[model samples]
Target: MLVELVGQSGRDLDNVSANPARLVNVYAERTTEGERVLKSVLGMDRHTQLDGVFVRAMGRVDGVTYAVCGGHLWRINLHGSANDLGAVDTGRATLCGNNGYVCVQAGTRYFVYDPDADTITEPAAGAFSDIGSVEFFGNYTVITEAGGRRFQWSALADPTDLPGLNFSTADGKDDNLLRGLAMDGRLYLFKQESTELWYNTGEAGADAMARVAGGVWDIGLLSRDMLCQFEGGAFIVGSDNRAHLVSSGGFQPVSIPPVETAIKIDRPQACLTYSDEGHTFCAIIFKDSPAWVYDLSMNEWHERAEGVNLGPWNVAASCKIGKEWAVGRNNGEISILRRTNADGSTPLVREITSRTLRMDGQRTILREFEVFPRQGFSAGTMNLHISRDGGSTWTPPKPKPIGGQGEYGRRVLWRNLGQARAINAKLRWTEPRDICLSTQARIVT
Candidate 1:
């Protein structure tokens, strides 16, 4: 009888003996035939490069895309061109758009960009010296006063108009407010140890918004940029060192043990959400670690790295321009996310490691192992590696041709006269051409 080696799952380093699957640069999805298969992640095609060190934020207003690169704000044209609008504070930025205006908050300065006038203007300084977060809700620009428990809003539809008295304190648990988000017509106030939900009441003054009686979530936000809206809710890195999906139902922990373990080791600096070919992904980026991507469609996790050094994926900000997903990278490059196999001209290294297979501690004779590569693939080689001692070490790679164009009948097979009680297998490939593994390797024991 033949036994399957790999299947649909993410990395589980916490318990490798039980589940040792590791997906890199690929995600698992169910096909129409009800079989799960791994698919390559869409690549980033360079759109434009700006004269700055890195892009800090991106947003769309009045059908135009805007980005903050280094100390300047720029307008990105649909034809992959950029125009420098003006200067702004240099640092991480928060952008929120409403009513043809985009509000920007960066490093103790608050500004608003009006596309119709083609200008960026700093709003009158409010009561706070620093702004923690910005969000649009109920025709108002909401912001949290950094290092404090007070939250404020601007005049209706006017991001430049701020009244000193137009603010309220979130005294829910006496914790300092860290960030805020507007989702489903509700304003979510996030703090260091808890979150409070408030909704618009259409009233005047202090009664303009009311808190949902029982809408307090015990989980707090990990950082200012670690929260983003997805589907109908929000994905947040909580202060408890785990990722959670916050919606009307409540907070649902989404980070598995291995993912959480990575989070605990390296703090996430930013989070971005985007959709590609019917799949939604939430990417968490760290300063010195590889990016961890969560596929909402598959409920699995994967790793995305950039450059020869295998560092973090360079995406720093993202926004939708028309129908395409435009991403701003840490190196001041704006790119369009495409369904290709290469990041611009760089081919991605796709890999998957299967779980450890143990035959109840009984050694068995291994016969042959074969894999079914998707038809119509061209120009690439798949390398297989095996480990007999539960991933403590791996054998030398054995390469097999995936066939050239029009050579779809090629078979990837390996015959061996070996015996082992437990084994782990890994497959890796790097080619610009489209490659897909229709089914994992089948081993006869």
Candidate 2:
């Protein structure tokens, strides 16, 4: 009997013990290169560090990028210049640009920055205290207070001032305390049990400003910083621990069971979401758990682990700067997600396992193992490990030389492999190149 496995996908680390056949990785994916290594933007350099702490908020004003770490702010230019702007607030902060100013909110306090003057000022503290999150809806600065049930927008095109004491409340039964985001000219409100969208009234004054569209509060958002925009819509980790795609029509679960099983429920606040254009996937990362990546192109799931790749992404904050993704790690370093190797030293790790092969309760003998690689890209070496008796143990890895760059249409074969009732095979590599592997197994009962 011959069994072939190609394009390994669908990873559920929570169920790996029971389902080891899925192609999963610490930091790898299946592209034209069977098991290609995933890349980070760039190395952790001085540009990503601020006051010995990782950036907590990243935003852009005019053409300048700003990174906030602790209470200090740094102005970053396109030419890679980082200038300290002294100290400001404490703890984690959120930033957004409204009109010509950068609006920053840390805790219940607020600070506004004028990009042209390079100055920061506090708004007159009267209205809009206890704000939880701030995002822009059209030209208005939309805000949600600490508790749910109500949200408001600032005066048109303004972030420092609001229109009187105007506020709008969600009349839905599930409008409990949560977060919000502004996208596509609508304000998305998330709660524990439901989600709601509000559109602009264009009134310019009081009377609750905006109203919730009927029947859109069907699903809710989980994880505060876990909202990221995708090609068709935005993806969020639902309060139910599932991944959802929120578009104009509402949301639907895009996460598989394995993706759902890997979330760290206890540390929900520590989760971060980002879209990787290189791999074309949306990654949901948790500090205490391995990353669960959803391939946007294939709509599939894969896993990423630090132990798999020498240094996987454990980012605290991430944003798309220009065309690439810039992220700040917990260790006080800034890195970019790129196709090249990190600092030319980080090793890439990949692992692909085949589905269990059963001989219908009859003992079998394995004769040979073969692997096929896609042509054209640079290739290195892969080690093979075989397991009999239901993947409980794997044989010592045997060395296999992979085809190098320009070695097109290459195939590797290993002969004289022993067999049992059930068996699985694994392929692993640790190089800074691509590995698109397709495997074939020969067995006899």
Candidate 3:
């Protein structure tokens, strides 16, 4: 019988019991270039690992980019050159840019970078000190204290002075923890157990900040690094242990059940989030597992594309400088994604693992297998591996031609795949470009 499989979708590794969602290196989508699936976000391999175990923060000021990794700040020049600024002795780094400077907070210490002078130094003696995190709104530099219950902003436009500025949410009520987010003309205070909205009270000079009339109680933010501002509001990890989109209509759940199941709550403090323009998606990463991507256009959840190793790629932090989207790797390397090839110098491997197909308790015989590449992918051969018994083992990989460019609709076939009680498949490619493809199987009962 000719069993025609539909288009392959993005990776759905969490779903081990069903088929229909095509787990692939890229998902199918119609673009201006024609109907094609995603190509794995290309990475800069020649840049290898940086001098740290993981990248903590990324920022750009005056055309110069910086990354906080291994407790030290490093100047990153995407052309493969970097300069370390020394150790910070902090577990995580919080960065915010204002005016012409970028401020960095590590533990109880704070430092500001002057890009014009190429200097990184602590603020003056009378300036604000002992800050845990930093955010800038207008000319005001806002910060939370170490183990403190309130947040404060600089006096006037000076982050180096404190005798005059008086902006804070210190109502002597609760410990309004976490960093502050300035959005839609209000300051959003995220506590460990609740959320508060504060706005300007029209009170001159000093008494400008005041809490909103009614705050969203009960719902609190969980991950500090996972907070992201989208077109509507912000997507964050809520106290309910699920991902939520907090906006004007109040907070609502957006993360699916499988994603919530994979989140490492105990590791909440380490999660990270960023947006991808190439794929039009937002990604929230729980360090211990494969990261989850939310399609901003579709408002649906999917897994990050996988490498040929058949495992999730390790991306710790991401930031956009100019038009390039760069990611900091868990291994301390900083590279750009969404390129046509892998890092230009290193050959990146791409893989696709299909969802489990059930034979309904009947042994199924695979008579033949057929593959189709996108109209543009012409030139390399792809390898195939078949797995039975739920991925316990896979047959030796088989190689098939992917055809050359201009050879659209060309099909490659393999005969006698052997019988199995249950099965799935994996396809890998090393020299593939525009490799959006589909497959079908000829089976016998």
Pick the lDDT winner. Answer: 1
CA RMSD, predictions in order: 1.9, 3.7, 4.1
lDDT of 2 by residue, 76-190 (tens): 6555556777566766667788877887766666777777787887766435477676676677777776665767667777677765466777667655646767766677777
Listed in order, each prediction's TM-score against the native is 0.94, 0.86, 0.81
Which candidate number maximizes TM-score? 1
Q: What is the lDDT of residue 435 in candidate 3?
A: 65
Error of 3 at 430 (Å): 3.2
Find the 10 residues in a row with the least total lDDT in model 1. 1-10
Q: The CA-based lDDT of model 1 is what?
A: 0.81
Model 2 lowest lDDT segment of ten: 37-46
**Cα lDDT, all candidates:** 0.81, 0.64, 0.64
Clashing pairs in 1: none
Report the lDDT tens digits of candidate 1 across residue range 421-443.
98788888878767777545677
Candidates in descending TM-score order = 1, 2, 3
